[model samples]
Target: MKLFRQVFLSIAAMLAVQGASAADARLPVVASFSILGDIVANIGGDRIVVTTLVGPDQDAHVFQPAPDHIKSVARARLVVVNGLGFEGWMERVTQSANYRGDIVVASQGIAVRDRVEEEHDHDSHDGHDHHHGKNDPHAWQNPANIVIYTQNIVAALSKLDPAGAALYRKNGDAYIASLNELDRWAIQQFAQFPPAKRKVITSHDAFEYFGAHYQVRFLAPQGVSTESEPSAKEVAGLIRQIRKEKIRAVFIENMSSPKLLQQISKEAGVTLGGKLYADALSQADGPAPTYLKLMRYNIGQLLAQMKLN
Candidate 1:
């Protein structure tokens, strides 16, 4: 009985040591939002543990980080964020959290376009201020932009965990290939539409990058951020423009308020084009759970809605 008890204790010690070592092997990362979290997970695979701040179907535009978010940041090995003023609150939160981790701006290499704010220049916004002259932060809306984001993620992860460099590279390369495939597919689908009919209306200006890349023109009542509301004059002008241009599809974004857009659709007398996953993605069982799925779902919605005469 004594010998058997000794063996059981030895086995338990060995298992505990193994668990500790396994825990130490993982690089803990904190992503400012869900989309970035998903991309990090794709590259990190099983080598890293990622904590997302803003979850799926959540808006990062007006996100107020909780007290726990500070603790998450402080404990992270790396912090990933979609820069370009997208997460205006992130810097302040990280500073307060005293996060001493390597910060990676995923949208580093992409050429940021100026957000057009003429529509909301005079409107009273509720929580946050989203002015148009600022740089648009929704680069992930474009797959080409995501190529840069993935490269940044892989580089950041490799720098943090040198032993997992090969895995990160392989995973990043595979994701880029998939992104390229989606790009080609989108190009072909958009090719079938005439320039005039390819116009779209989304809740906010998040899809500007998508429009720029795919040759579709997107009009929005709100600015880049969902915090801003369009004035009555802007709505009237948009209604007139839609009537004049014969625009077909108007979409509601997952992150923005549907009330305003719904009103716009009713006033404009156009069918509400299905919901587009803009700033954030859907739940796991929904159409857009991953970054790839988000883009495909948005594209599918655009194609289906634009096809309506």
Candidate 2:
């Protein structure tokens, strides 16, 4: 009888250890950039451990993956990326790391706006041709597209950790509701401006999605990628266009240099509209620390620049 009791106690200890191990484990997730990292955190909450490769105010357009990032991706149960060709180096990094985990494209199913369509939309009133790329990967600029992002994130997280599915869905639903509200708010707010007054200049052509949704026309001296420089002729044309259009303000992006934009503003005789967050979020205490705050802050800054507020 004593021997039997010993064996039972040993089994109970093993069970306890197993339970503790299970309780201590959390889902590991890796996101390509800061904006997507925030969205994943919102859905995952404390149920997952998230690592962001490109952090706040960091430019993913020219991000270089570190060894630490490879290590993180190697061990992560799931990897999240902004697909629309946004993370140009992500595939190579994952391949180099031999990351075998599931990769979820957060922007999946979000209607991709190619550069040709973007140029057509921007210059619809005119017959000017724009030398642009084939794809514009900044879909998150539109709050409506964020709905698709939240859904994709929730689905991916739920699939990876079914036990935490309910919590992820709840968080995702709440966040998406906020996005919907933001969409409505932006529509109403931007409606205050007439089409003629909705034009502005930004550092890069990152706001095509935002412009499509908000009826605001964004003109940029540089192409979609900040890594590329605008030629002298392009700059001259932009200056002429700004002067002709009476574009009141030219804004600098959070992740781009203000020198070129400042130069454009000076030569174009326009005010420097406050810095806008395009590719990444700002520091913790800055105007656009969070994704939601980023959208609101951008609209507010632009509206204030137009004296519409």
Candidate with the greatest TM-score versus the true structure: 1
Query: Where does the lowest 10-residue lDDT sum fall in candidate 2?
Result: 116-125
1-309 per-residue lDDT for model 2 (tens digits): 999999999999999999778656978899998888888898899898889999999999899988999899998999999988889899898898898889999888988887742232333246565444577899999989989999999999898889999999999999999999999998999888888888888998899999988988898877788898887877877787788778885789999999998898898787787889999999898888889999999999888876621
Tell me the spans in candidate 1 whose CA falls farther than 4 Å from its real position.
1-13, 117-132
lDDT of 1 at 253: 83
**Candidate 1 residue-wise lDDT, 139-214, digit = tens:** 9989999999999999999998899999999999999999999999999999999887798888888888888899
lDDT of 2: 0.87
- Score candidate 1 by TM-score against the native: 0.91
lDDT of each: 0.88, 0.87
Worst 10 residues of 1 by lDDT: 120-129
Per-residue error at 150 for model 1, in Å? 1.2
Question: Which residue pairs collide, candidate 1?
Answer: none
Error (Å) of candidate 2 at residue 180 is 0.6
